[model samples]
Target: MSDALEKAEAAVREASTDTAAVQLAFAAMELAKAAQQQAQTVPQHHQCEHQHKPRRSAGEWLGIACAVCVGGVGIAFASLALAILGGTAAIVVLVLRSMWTDYQRKGR
Candidate 1:
């Protein structure tokens, strides 16, 4: 009976140790699967394949050109007024026109 009990105890200990090892192996497999999934899901940066789109249509260009001509005339009148008023208004008008030209060039 004592020998039989010892054998049963040894068997239980072996089985418990085997269960622990199997659990650890399962955990390691889960970690490896997670790492593989993460590797597969990683995003890579690639060059953009998009093209530039123009902001204005043909009709828009015509309208913008007309507006610029009108604005130039208005600025000329304002400059004349500034000249008569005897202040820096003429300089301001010139600066504004310069900025407008720069803006138009950049838009193109």
Candidate 2:
């Protein structure tokens, strides 16, 4: 940037017309100002691109496994209870229907 600015200064001094010299000087000043600003600016620290996650411990995994087992057992018990309840309901319905037919035959 300094080298470019020096070249621009030389060009402006060697320019024949005042108008051309003034334009070249203005351009050099803008370049120098930009370089100064860039130098004064602070550099930013780069962060890791990937996310950081803590790994699960063995105890946590064991706890999760135990919970899954308990859930499975609970579901099994619920299924068994539903089967029993359904069987009992079917039996009650069959008994009631049989009694109804018997009563109707007796009335006839």
Candidate 3:
């Protein structure tokens, strides 16, 4: 536990007057709040400052174009072809997601 918490406990344990206990309790609360703020925060320089994620790469753009073309062609062929196209698009999207995640992990 924190030093402030230990002190708070000691204050509570040894209190002789209601006023003294209240003052100690308030001090303990402020300490707890300060500690919480410190623990929850990160340095501004350590955070992401970009307004948006970087643009997709050339290969990623190409993949998106192919997916869009497949979707467009599926519109002309109707039900069965559309379903196949949708499934293919789903698989491609999953593969791309895994690739992106791996790329990010490696970069980190």
Candidate 4:
């Protein structure tokens, strides 16, 4: 019997006027006792058992390294393309501005 169940039983005995209250208290005490017994019978354990994954093999590691290298090369190419595009745009803008200024001066 748990400490809480014992206390409740003692309290119920002291004030056992209401028959319904006494019955409810007795039912609760019984449940507590049943749970206590179940706990003792069953083994304690963590809620979640940790499952460890197997370590990567040499072949898997080599494949992963190759994938990383390919990804890095792709990123480098993309950056280089963007830089070229920006430089071309700047040159075009400067050339157009100069042509417009020369045309205006000739007109004046």
Best by lDDT: 4
Q: What is the lDDT of residue 59 in candidate 1?
A: 98
Clashing pairs in 4: none
Candidate 4 local Cα displacement, residue 9, angstroms = 94
lDDT tens per residue, model 3, 1-108: 699999998887677477787999999999999999997796677878669878999999999999999998887678878789999999999999999999999998
* TM-score-superior candidate, 1 or 3: 1
Model 2 clash pairs are: none
- Give the per-residue lDDT digits (tens) of candidate 4, residues 25-64: 9999999999999878876673468888999999999999
Clashes of each: 0, 0, 0, 0
- What are the TM-scores, per candidate, against the unseen true structure? 0.41, 0.54, 0.29, 0.51
Q: Return model 2's CA RMSD, one decimal.
A: 17.3
Best by TM-score: 2
Across residues 1-108, which tens digit of lDDT does each residue of candidate 2 receive? 999999999888776577787899999999999999987785655545788899999999999999999999999999999999999999999999999999999999
Pick the winner on TM-score between candidates 1 and 4: 4
Give candidate 2 regions above 4 Å deviation.
1-47
What's model 1's overall lDDT?
Answer: 0.92
lDDT of residue 39 for candidate 2:
75
> What's the ranking of the predictions by TM-score, best on top?
2, 4, 1, 3
For 1-108, candidate 1 gives per-residue lDDT tens digits of: 999999999999999999999999999999999999988887765536789797888999999999999999999999998788766767789899999999999999
Which runs of model 4 end up more than 4 angstroms from their true locations?
1-49
